[model samples]
Target: MVYKMSVYYRATMCITLMLLLLNLCEKGYGVNLRDMQVPCEEVYMVKEGETLNSISEKCGDPFIIEENPHINDPDDVFPGLIIKITPFRLYSYKF
Candidate 1:
């Protein structure tokens, strides 16, 4: 009778742990990229009426000029100009 009770207690603990893990997963409590500040894209093309400031805000890349040294003038960004965007989170991970 004691052995049987021990077995049942172990099974109950296992089930409780499994249910807790499932509940956490269902609640989205994990390392989700969407929940983090990730960059929208690595390479971005300048669109009409879009400035570096606007792109930085939209893409989550604050240092646009630093990433793309070719951008001589921040104000000279024109449509179709390609630029490299590295989000601060990704940049920090590299080091």
Candidate 2:
């Protein structure tokens, strides 16, 4: 009977320690929505009467600025174009 009681007490202590460690680790690794929340980059759809200057004002500046050599070429951007105002970074979680 004494041996059985000792074994049961040890098992109980081990289970309790395991539970405590698991709880602490979960809190350390869990991601809170507010902590990870990031603002979405604003994108503009080119309109018929929109100009680059106006778009720049509305969307701030682009991360990259490349000037097209041919302003009148077929690939030249016009009003009502979709432009990305911000770049995104990939994030990894390490626990």
- State the lDDT of candidate 2 residue by residue for 5-83, as single tens digits: 9999999999999999778656765443334432334554667766656555555453323432223443456776566
lDDT of 1: 0.81
CA shift of 44, model 1, Å: 0.6
lDDT at residue 26 of model 2 (Cα atoms): 66
Best by lDDT: 1
- Quote each prediction's TM-score: 0.61, 0.31
**Candidate 1 TM-score, true structure as reference:** 0.61
RMSD of 2: 9.3
Model 1: per-residue Cα lDDT over 1-95, one tens digit each? 99999999999999999999777766666644444565666788899999999999888778888889899889999999999988555332210
For each candidate in the order shown, give its overall lDDT on alpha carbons: 0.81, 0.56
Worst 10 residues of 1 by lDDT: 86-95
